[model samples]
Target: MTRSVYVTGIGRGDGRQVIELGVMELLTRHVDRVGVFRPLVHDDGPDRLFDLLRSRYRLTQPADSVYGMGYEAAGTLQAERGTDELVSHLVDRFHAVAREYDYVLVLGTDYADTNLPDELSLNARLANEFGASVLPVVAGRDQESESVRAEARNAYRAFDSMGCDVVAMVVNRVAPADREAVVERLAAHLPVPCYALPEDSSLSAPTVSQIVHTLGGEVLLGDDSGLARDARDFVFGGAMLPTFLKALTDGCLVVAPGDRADLIIGALAAHSAGAPPIAGVLLTLGERPGPDIMALAARLAPGTPVISVPGGSFPTAGELFAIEGKMSAASPRKAETALGLFERHVDTVELTKRISVLKSDRVTPMMFEHELIERSRSGRRRVVLPEGSEERVLRAADVLLRRDVCDLTLLGEEEAIRKRASDLSIDLGDAQIIDPQTAPVRERFAERYAELRAHKGVTQELAYDVVADVSYFGTLMVQEGLADGMVSGAVHSTAATIRPAFEVIKTKPDAQIVSSVFFMCLADRVLVYGDCAVNPDPNAEQLADIAIQSAATAAQFGVEPRIAMLSYSTGTSGSGADVDKVRKATELVRERRPDLLVEGPIQYDAAVDASVARTKLPESEVAGRATVLVFPDLNTGNNTYKAVQRSAGAVAVGPVLQGLRKPVNDLSRGALVQDIVNTVAITAIQAQGGTAQDAPSGR
Candidate 1:
C-alpha cells in the first residue's frame, strides 16, 4: 500500500508549502515514484504548489489527476450533496492517484476564500478518512515566542484530538532568535517530532521577474535570466542620481519616474561595475526615457532588466509591498533555498520513520541535486570564480551565497564586480572580491612562480605578467593558502583556465594524470561519464588511471563504483587497437585495485542497458549496472555525452577535473547560472576532502 502524508495548516499565512515541498523532497530521495494530490484548489489560477512540485520533481502524473475539486465546485457539492458526500467524492479521486504510485503527497486546502465552516475540523476529518499521517504547520511570523509555542501545540492537538495520525509538527517563519526556544518547547510537550524553521526573507522576497509579472510591466532591456534576479528590497529613487546611487541596496528594486534618466543610467552603471546587483529598474508614471538614453542604459548593463510600469511610483510601490511572493516553478532558486532551510531544521529521519515508507533502489534527479547541496553545506569550503564579471558566474555566486553553500571570492575588479552585483540586485554578503591587478600578493606570487618555474627559465618579469592574469592569480591564491579551490572557464578557454593549475597546483602524488568526469543526471539515476572533457587519446596506463580516478570520484559523490571500460567491442567479440587498449586498461585496473567491480571491452549498450547486457554478457556483474563508464578516448567520450545530453534531456553536471592537489574545476563557455552553481558546489565538496587528498588547510 502507498504511504500518504497530508501537509495541512490550521489557517492561512502558515507558509505550509515549505513543509509540503520539503516532504516531497524527502520522499523522492527515498523512493522513485511519488505522487501529489490536492483535495481542493482555487479555480482563479493555476495551483502554485502543485505546479512547483510537478515541474521540480518531473512528475509524470497528468495535471487533472492531481486535484479532486476546485473551490467553487467543492462549495456547490457541499451545499447540494452535503459535507460527507463532498469529502467522500474527493476521497475517491485521491485514492485513484494513491493506488498508482508508491507514495502520495496530499496537500490540504489553504484557508483563503473557503467560505466553509469549521475548516480545521474538516481537514482533520478528511485526513483521517484518507488514512494519511497528518503533519500540521503553524505560522509563527510576527508572534511572541510563547504564542508561537502555544499555537504549535494547539495545532498538533487539533489534529490528534480528531484521532488523525499526527506524525510531526512544524512551526514556520518564527523569528530566528526564537526558533530554538520554540522548537525546544514544542518538542518537550508534543508526542511527535517538532521542527521550527526561522524566518528567511529570501523565501518571501519577490524577484524582479515576479514583480514584473505582478505589475504587467514591459521589459525595456533585461533578458529573462536577469529578470529572474531576486528583488530583496524596493528602493524609491526620487532624489538626485548621487543620493539615489547612495540609497541603492543589494538586490533592491529601483522605483523612479521614467523621466529620471540620470537615475536609470547611474543605477545600470553602478550594476555594471558591480556596486550591488539591483533586481531591476522599475520606471514609473506611464513615461519612459528616450531611445538614446535607453540605449545608454542597455550599454551600461547589457542584460540587466529595465521595466516600465504605467502606474505612478507611489501606487506601484504599494502594489509591490502588498504582493506576497509565492513558491512557483519560475523561481527555482527560492525553492532551493526553502529546501535547504527545511532540511537544516527538520529531522527527516524521525519523520520518515514515523511515516514508515519503504526505500526504493532508484535515485531521482531531484534527489541527486538535493544531495549535492546537502553534502556541500556539511563542511563549507572557500571557492573562487576567476571570471567573476561573467553574468552566469555572478548569478551563480548569488545563489551560492543565499544558500550558504560556500565561502566565495570573485577574482576581478572589486568595484566593477560590486557594481554588476548591485545592478543585478544580488547581495554577495561577505563573499570577498579582489582585483588581481592590484592585490598585495601579486609581487610575492610572481616571485614564487618564478622560483617554481626556474627549471623552465621563467624570469620574474614574465612571472609577474602571468600572475596578473585572473586564472593565474586565483591558482596562486589556492597555492598560497588563500582560497580553498577555484572554478573558472565561464568565459575563458579550458586550456587557459586549467593551465595555471597544471603549472602551480599540479596533480597529486598518486595520480599519474589529471582527468575529468560528468555527473550525468538521468531520469532515474546519476551515472558517471569520465574523460569526456579532458585527455585526447589515452594509452592503456593513462586509461587505467582514469578509470581508477573516475571510480574514486563516483564514490566521493555517493555513487558506488562499478567500472565499465567502454570499447566498440564487447568482451573480445571484436579485435582492434581500440578494443585491445580497453582490454589492457581493464587488466591493469584489476591488477591495481582487485577489489573494484570491473567489466571491460564492453560495448556502450552492454554497459548500461540490461537487455543488451543479457544478450551480450549476462553473467558479468558490471555489464548492465555500471555506475561509472570510463571511455577509451576523449573523442568517443565527449561525443557520446553530448548526444545523450541533448537527445535524452539529461543534466550533465561536470567536466569536474580530478587528481588536482586542490579542487579547481572548469565551466563551459555557455554554462548557465545553475551549471556554474553545481560546478562550484562540486569544487567545494572536492575541497572538503571529497577527493583522495584533503584540501590543504587555510587555502
Candidate 2:
C-alpha cells in the first residue's frame, strides 16, 4: 500500500509551502517514485508551489494528474452538489496518483480567498479520506510564544477530533528570538512533535522577477540569474547621485524615474564598483533611459536587471512592498534556503519515524546521494576542501553548510575566497578559511611534514615549501588530527591530492596497497567498481587485496558484497595471462575469507546478467548478483567506468580512496558542485568509521 502525508495550512500566510517542499524532499530521499497531489488550488493560472515541486524534484507525474480541481470549481461543487460529492471526486483523483507511485504528498486546501465554509474541517475530512497522516501548519507570525504554542495545540486537536492522524505540527514565521520558546512550550503540551521555524527575511523578500510580474514591467536588461536575486529592501532614488548611492544596500532594488539618468548611472556604477551590490534597478513613470545610457548601464553591470514600469514611483513602491516571494520553479535558491531552514529546525529523523514510510530496497541515484548526506549528518565530522578558491568548491561549501551536513574548512587565501563568494552571491556561513602561507599552523605542519619525511632527505626548510601547497597542507591536517579527512583535486591533479597522504597518512597495518573505487549509481541500484583510480597494474596478490578493500568500502556504504572478478573469459572459455591473474585472485579471496561469495575469470556479461550466468557458469552464487566488481587493470577500469557514466547516465561518485589510516579522497578536476558535495560527505562518513551495519539504513 502507498503511504501519504497531508500538509495543510490553518489559514493563509502559514508559509506551509516550506513544509510541503521539505516533506517532498524527505519523501524522495527514501522512496524512488513519489507523487504530488493538491486537492484544491487557487483559480490562478497555475499552482506555483506544485510547479516548484515538480521542477525541483523532477517529478514525472503528468500536469493534469497533479490537481483535483481549482478553488472555484471546488467551492461550486461543495455548494451545489454538497460536500460529500466534492470530496468523493477529489478522493478518486488522489487515488489515481497514489496507485501509480510508492508514496504521495497530498497538499490540502489553502484557505486563501476561498468561499468554502469551515476550511479546517474540510481539510481534515479530505486528509482522512485520502488516508494520509495530517501535518498541520500554524502561522506564528506576529504572535507571542505562548499564543503560538496554544495555536499549535488547537490545530492538532482540531484535526485529531475529526479522526485525522495528526503526525506533527509546524509553527512557521516565528520571530527568531521566540523560536526556542515556542518549540519548548509546544513540546511540553503537545502530544506530537512540534517544530518552530524562525522567520527568514529572505524567504519573505520578493525577487526581482516577482516585482516585474507584479508591476507588469518590461525587462530592458538582465539575465535569469540576476532576476532571481532577492530584493531585500527598496531604495528610492529621488535624492542626488551621491546621497542616492549612499542609500543603496546589498540586495536592494533601486526605484527611480527613468528620466533620472544621473542617478541611474551612479547606482549602476556603485553596484559595479561593489560598494553595495544591488539586486537590480526599477524604472518608474513610463520613462526609459536613452540608448547610450542603457548601453553604458549594460556595460557597467551586464547581468543586472533594469525594469521599466508604466506606473509612477509611489504606486510601484506600494505594489513592490505588498509583493511577497513565492517558492516557484524559477526560484531555486529560495528552495535551497527553504530546505536549509527546514532541515536545520526540524528533527527529520524523528519526523521520518513518525511518518512511518517503509524504506525501499532498491537504491536509486537520488536515494544514494540522500543517504550519503544523512549519514554524514548523523555523526558530524570536519572535512577540509583544499580547492577553496575554486568556484565549484565554494558552491559545494555553501550547500554543505546550508544543509548542516558537516563542519567544513576551506583552504585558500581568506580574502580571495570571501571575494569570490561575494561575487557569486554565495554565503559560506561560518566555514573556516585558512591561507596556508600565512596560517600559524603552517609552521607546525611544516615541522610535522619534515619529521614524517625525514628518511627521504627532507629538511624542515624543504618541508616548509612543500606544506605551502594546498593539497599537502590539507593532507597534513588529516594526518595530524586537525581535520578528520580532506577532499581536494577539483583543480589539482589526483596525484597531487593523494601523494601527501601516501607520505604522511600511509596505508593501514593490515592493508597491502591503497586503491580507489567509484560508486556507480545506476538507475536501480549501486555497484562498486574497484581499482579504477589509484593503481595502474597489480599482481595477483595485490589484486586480491584491492578486492578485499573494495568489499569493505562497498559494505561500509550499504552496498552488498558479492564479489565479481571481471575478466575477458568466463569459466574455462579462454586462456591468457589476464585470465590467469583473475583466476588466482579469486582463489586468494576465497582462501583468505572463506565466507565470501566469489566468482573468478568471469565475463562482465555473465557476472551481471542472470541469463548469461545460467548459460556460462550455472549454480554460482556470485555470478549474476554481484555488487562489487573488481577490474583487472586501471586501463580497462577507468575507461569502462567513464563509458558507463556518460552513455548510461549513471552518477559516478568517487575515486574514493580506501585503505588509508585517515580518509583522504580526491575529486576529478572537472567535478561539479554536487560531485564535490557528495565526495565531502563520503569523506566525512569515512572519518566516522563508516560501517553499513551501524550506519542509518535507507532500506
Candidate 3:
C-alpha cells in the first residue's frame, strides 16, 4: 500500500509551500519513488509548488497526474452536485497517483480566495478520504506565542476529531524570538509532534528573475544564470551616483529611471568592483540608456542583469511590495534555505516514526549526492579554499554560501580574488578572504611551522618563506584551528597541496600511511576506490591500513562498508606479488577489525557482478556487494577511477586525502565548480568526525 502525507494549512500566508517542500524532501530521503498531488490548484499555468517539487526532487510523474481539479471547477461542482461528488472525483484522481508511487505527498488546499465553505473541514475530509495522514502548518506570523500554540492544538484537534490521523503540527513563520515559547507551549498542549519554523527572509525574498517576470520587463543585459540571482531588497536610485552607491546593500535590486546613465553605470561598476553585487538594474519609466552606454554597461558587469520596466519608480515600488517569492525551478537557493530550516527545527525521527516511511535499499546517485550535502549541513564545519583566485573555487564558494552548507575561508590575495569573483558575477557573501602573505597570524603560523619542522632543520626565516604559499598557509589555518579543514589544488598540483599537510599537519597516530579515495558515484550507487591519488605502491601493511581507512570513509558518508581487496585473480586462482600483497592485506584487515566483512584476491567482475560472483566466489560475504574497493597500487586505482569517470559518466568526487590529523583535501586542477563543492563537503564532513561514524548495520 502507498503511504500518503497531506500538508495543509488553515489560512493564507501560512507559507505551507515550505512545509510541502520539506515533506517532499523528507519523503525522497526515505523512499526512492515519491509522487506529488495537489487536490485543487488555482490555475492551469504551471502549479508553482508542484513544478518546484518535481524539478528539485527529479520526480518522473507528469504534472497532469498531480492536480485533481481547478479551483473554480471544484467550487462549481460542489455547489451544483454537492460535496460528495466533488470529494469522490478528487479521491479517484488521488488514487491514480497513489498507485504509481511508493509514497504520495498530497498537498492540501490553500485557504485562498476559494468559494468553498469551511475550508479547514473540507481539507480534513479530503485527507481522510484519501487515507492520508494530516500534517497541518499554522501561520504564526504576527500572532502571539499563546495564540500560535492555541491555533496548533485547535488544528490538530480539528483533524483528529474527524477521525484523521494527525501526524504532526508545524508552526510556520513564527517570530524568531517567540519560537521557543511557542514550541514549549505547544509541547504541553498538542498530542502530536510540533515543529516551529522561524521566519527566514531569504526564503521569502524575490529573485531578480521573479521581479523581471512580474513586471513584464525586457532583459537589456545579463545572462540567464545571473538573472537567477536573488533580489533580497530594493534600492531606489534617486540621488546622485555617489549617494546612490552608498545606499546599496548586498543582493539589493537597484530601481532607478533608465535615462540616468550615471546611476546605471555606477551600479554596474560597483558590482564589478565587488562592493556588493546588485541583484539587477531595474530601469523605470521604460527609459533606456543609449547604445554606447548599454554596451559599456554590459562590459562593466558582464552578466549583471539590467531590466527595463514600463512604469515609473513609484508604481514599480508598489508592484514590488505586492510581489511575493515562490520556490520555483529557477530559485533553488531558497529551496535549500527552506530545507535547511525544516531540517534544523523538525524532529524528523519522530515525524518519520509516525508516518512509517521506509528507508531505501538502493542508494541512487542523486541520493548519494544529496546525502553528502545534507550531512555536511547537519554539522557545518569551516573549510578553507587556498585557490581563492581560481574561478572554479570561487564559483563553488558562491554555491556553498547560497546553500548555507558550510563556513568557508578563501585564502589568497584579497583584491585578486574579489576581481575574479566580480568577473564571474559570483558573490562571496561574508566568506572570510585572507592573504597568506599579510594575514595577522602569519608570524604565529611561521613559528608553528618552524617548530613542527625543527627536526628537518627549518629556521624561522625559512618557515616564513614556506608560509607565504597559499597552500601551506591554508593547511596552517587548519592546524592552528582557524579553519576545520582545507581544500586546495584547483590550480596547484596535488603534491603542492598535500605536501604542506605532510610537513606540518602530519598523519594520525594510528595511520601507517596517508591514502586517498574517490567516491565513484555511478548510475545506482556510490563505491569507494582507495589509494587512487596517493601512495604509489603500498606494501601489505600499508594496503591493510588503506582498506580500513577506505571502509571508515565509506561508512561515514552513509555507504555500508563491504571490503573487496582487488586483484587480477579471484580467490587464489592465480598467485603473484600483486595478488599476494592484496591477499595479505585482506587477512590483516580481517584480523585487525574482526567485525568487518572483507574478501580477498577478488577480480573486478566477481567483486561487482552478482552472476560472476556466484560462479567464482558465491560463498564470500563481500563479493558482488562490496562498497569499498581496495587497490594494491595507485597505478591500477587511478586508471580505473579515470576510466569509469570518463567512459561510464560517473561523478568522481574525491581524491579525499584520508588519515590526516586535521582534514586537508586536494582537488583536481581541472575540477568543475560542482566537483570543488563536493570535495569541500567531503572535507567538512571529515572535519566533523565523519570517518569515525559507523554506517547503519544492514542495507
Candidate 4:
C-alpha cells in the first residue's frame, strides 16, 4: 500500500535542483504528501537553506536533522562514509521516515563519487532497506558524457541485479543531435525509459528572491548562496482570503497568515525533495508590511522569494465563501475568483481519462476531450445499442448517443422503455429502442435461433432460451451484418462478451491469435500491456506473436512501439528455461519482422532504463529499454503489470481484444455503466479507424 520511490543523488548538485523541479511538477498531477530525506548533510556550522525551510514551513521535525544525529559522520571524508556505510545510513533514514509516512523519498548525498558501482550499490541497499523500487537518474551539472555510457550501463546492471523494477536515466544538458545517439546508445544496452534533457539553463537556479520579487515581497533570510528557485509547480498562499482555493490550479497551495501554515506546508512539500516538488504561497498581513512585518520575513525567505502580503480590503457582497480557514468572513469576489482559477487549469479532463489508475472511490465526470465524443464528418460509425435497464446504463447510452460517437439502437419493450426511463428519470427519445419482446428482432431472433439450433441441439425450449439473453441476440445482429461493432460487457464476463463474437463474427485470416491489451496510463504516458488477462501461459512463439500484435495495437493508440521481451534476467545474467523462452521469442520476432525496434531477455528496468541502454549490451537494439514490454510468461507478466497497476497507483484500461479481425472488448464483471460506455467508445474508435493516440498527459 505504501508505494515509495527512491530519488537519490549527490550533494545539492548533480543536476538535482533541476531534476527535483521535474519531479515536483510531475507530483502535482499525482500524489498528495510527497516527503524528502537527506540522510547526510555536511555539518558546516549552520545550513541556512535548511534552516529557512524549518521556519517558513513550521515543520515539527526540521528536515535538517530528524533526530539527535550528531556531526560525527556527516561528510564523505569521514571514515564511515564508504559505500556500505553510506547505504546503511541511507537505509536507516528511509526506515525511520517510512514508519510515519506512506511513502518515503530517499535522497543521496552529492558527497558520494558518481561511480556506477557505488550508485547502484547504494540504490540496492536502499531498496532492500525501504522495500522500494529504484527510478535512477544520471545526475550532475556537467556536460554530456562523451563516453560515460559504460558507467551508466554498469549502474543499471547493479540496480537490475538487486531487483529494482523500473529505472530511468536523465541525461542532463544533452545536445539535440546527441539526443538520438544517446537514446540509441542506451536503448542498445538497457530496457528502460531514457530521457535526454536539453540544456535549459532557465530551470537550473531557483532563487527565493525571484519568487518574492515577482510577488513584490522580500528575502527574509539566507539571501545568498545555493538556494534553488526553478519550481516545476507553484502555489499561491494568503492568510486573509482568496488564497486557499488557488491550490485547485497547478500546484499545491496553503492558506495561512504566518509561520504555522508555512511550517506544515513546507515540511510536507519538501519530503520528496528529489522526487516531487512542493511549495507554499504565503500571504502576509494587510498587504504593506510595516517595520515589524518586514523583519518577520527577513527570517523566512532566506535565499527564497517572499511575496508582499495583500494590501487593500474590498467589501464582501454575496455567498462566495461564507467562511475562511478560521471561519472568518470571505468576500464573494475573492473566493469565487480563486476557485475559478483552479478549475480552469488543474486538469479535470486528464483525471477523467485515468480514473481507474487513481483507484479512488469517488469521482466527478470531467469530460474535456472533443475527440472522444466527436464523430468525423465522413467516419460516423453508427452503432445500435439496447436501451432501458439501469439508471447508470441508460445515462451512459445517452452520453454516447448524444455525442454522436455511436448511433445506439436500444432494444426493449416500447412501454417498458418509457417506464424504465421514467423510473430511472432519464430521457429515451434520443436513442432508438427496438422492442425485441414485441418488435422485429424478437421475430428475427426466433427465426435465427430455430435456423441455427435446428441442426442438432434442436428444441423450441433451446430456441427461446437462446433468443432471451439480449447480449446473445445483439451479437447475432452484428453477425447478420445489422451492425458494425457490438459493445456487450456491461454486466457480463469476458467469456460472455467474447463467446458471442467467437460464435458469430469469428476470426480474421492472418489474425492467428486472440489476446488483449490493458492500456496502463499515468500522468505523462500511456503504456499498452498485452496478454495480461487473456493468454494465461503462452509459448515462446505465441509471446513473440503477442509482442508483434501488441506493438501494432500500441501504434494504433499513437505509441511508438519500442518492444522489449520482458524477462526476469537482462541478457545472460540469469539462467533458466523461462529466460531462454524470452530470448528465443525475441529472436523469432527479429527474424520474422526486422522493421520494428525490438529486443528481449530484458528485465523491466532494462526495457525502460535509458542509462542502462548506454552500457550493458549497448550495441543491441532493445536491451536497455522497451516501452512495449513482452512478458516472458503470464505469471510474471500478469502479476508485474497488475502490481504496477495497483502499487504505483496506475489505471488499467482493458483486456482489449488484439489480433482479432474485429474489435471485441472485455469489461470488468462488476463494471459501472460508464465503464460500459467507455468500452463501447474504445471499440468504436478501433473500428472507426483513427490513429492510435499518445498517452493522455497523465493527471
Per-model CA lDDT versus the true structure: 0.87, 0.89, 0.86, 0.52
For candidate 4, what's the RMSD?
21.1
Q: Stretches of candidate 1 above 4 Å error? A: 208-231, 234-320, 349-352, 609-619, 690-699
Better of 3 and 4 by TM-score: 3
Which one is best on lDDT? 2
TM-score of each: 0.90, 0.94, 0.91, 0.45
Candidate 2 per-residue C-alpha lDDT over 186-235 given as tens digits, one digit per residue, 9 for 90 to 100: 98999999999999998899988889888899999998767888899999
What C-alpha lDDT does candidate 4 achieve relative to the native structure?
0.52
The TM-score-based order of candidates, best leading, equals: 2, 3, 1, 4
TM-score of 3: 0.91
lDDT of 3 by residue, 332-393 (tens): 66776787688778886678778888877766656666677777887879999888888778
TM-score of 1: 0.90
User: Per-residue CA lDDT of candidate 4, range 1-699, in tens?
Assistant: 555655554232344433433342233224333455655554544443334323422334546434213334533423445656655665676566656643344554454333334434554666666666565555423545545355557657767777765546555545545656776787677776555544433233233333444444433333232122223233434342323333423222222344444433342333223112233334454233356544544443323233434432121101112211110011111112222222222233332232212322211121112223332212556454543464556666655543345666665565555544432223343566665555556566666767765766556666666666666666776666566566655666778778766655666675567877776754345666777877778888888889888888777655678888887677788788888788888888898889988877877777767787666668876665465877766677678777987788765667678766666677666667656666677667667765644322212
Worst 10 residues of 1 by lDDT: 690-699
Segments of candidate 3 deviating more than 4 angstroms: 378-380, 389-391, 398-404, 414-430, 454-457, 522-525, 587-595, 642-651, 670-674, 690-699
Identify the candidate with maximal TM-score. 2
Considering TM-score, which of the candidate structures 1 and 4 is the better prediction for this target? Answer: 1
Error of 3 at 567 (Å): 1.9
Off by over 4 Å in 4: 1-371, 374-378, 384-388, 411-417, 435-439, 442-464, 623-625, 693-699
- lDDT (10s digit) by residue, model 1, range 1-699: 888999999999988888899899878877778999989888899888888988888889999999988888888889998999998998899899988999999999899998877889888988988899999999999999999988888888778889999988899999999999998888789888889999988888887888888999998888876887777888998887888899998778889899988898898877776675677899998798998998898888887899999999879988999877888998887887888788789887678788877766666666676667666877888898898887689889987876778899998888778766665556677999989899998999999999999999999999999999999999999999899999999899999999989999999998999999999988777899999998999899999999999998888888888999999889969998888999999999999999999999998899999999999999999999998999999999999999999999889999899988998999899999888888888888888884422111100
